[model samples]
Target: MHSKTYILISFHTAELGNPDIVFLISIVLAFTFIMFLTCEILLQGSLRDHSEPNDEYVIPHGDWFEIVSSPHYLAEIVIYAGLVVASGGTDLTIWLLFGFVVSNLVLAAAETHRWYLQKFESYPKKRLAIIPFAY
Candidate 1:
């Protein structure tokens, strides 16, 4: 992911000619750090509350789990979106990568949501697959 952002930066820099290196580096670093933190927080929250293998399956609660079936997947999409923004938001490749990530995660979240519905009749009817209030 960082590699792809670096490539986009290189392409953008080459086309624009002598863009501010410090500013670009700052943007990249900031986005990378945010992506790392967001993924850690959301994924960790999901995993921490997850049911143990021997335990009966239970729907997770708290954090973004209450809002969507797959908060971890949402984190992934956010990470890619941050990369796209860090890449100056004009690169075709980065946008395509973001689209790919979103599509795959959306599909996965939908499947997870379906599984939850099948497994537990008491699953919240208000919960969405991935996006909050919208799927």
Candidate 2:
């Protein structure tokens, strides 16, 4: 009982000395750009019309919207995925965060997909709820 000691906290070391840092940084930056691009596309595609989805409801006709009901959500998952990959996936914390993001987004996307199908008979039949060609 006298030997009880507090656990010491260790800080994550900077990987700037490693060559892999360059590659990892590039990947992270690329995905960050992609995330912003997806957001812009969503804003561009949907914000123009004052009307909510109806019979004439124009779902974003091009790009990711053609593939999934929730491009924004997919983009978010991709962003986190990039972070996980950049961390070399040794960090369980990042993976747990990624899982949380995926679960929440999947649920939202699925609900949105259901609403889209119910509201519009012409909703792209081939499009997936979230993950393309799988979900």
Best by TM-score: 2
**How much does each candidate deviate from the true structure in C-alpha RMSD?**
6.0, 9.4
lDDT of 2 at 48: 62
After TM-score superposition, the amount by which residue 10's alpha carbon in candidate 2 deviates from its true location, in angstroms, is 21
Residues 1-135, candidate 1, lDDT per residue (tens digit)?
Answer: 999998986886786565695367557767767767866786667666645564565577777888899887887787787787666678999999999999999999999999999999999988999988888
RMSD of 1: 6.0
Give a tens-digit lDDT track for model 2, residues 1-135: 333321111112244445466556666869777787877878686656555556655666667788888888888888888888767677999999999999999999999999999999878899999898887
Q: How many backbone clashes does candidate 1 have?
A: 0
Error of 1 at 38 (Å): 4.0
In order, candidate lDDTs are: 0.80, 0.77
Number of colliding residue pairs in model 2? 0
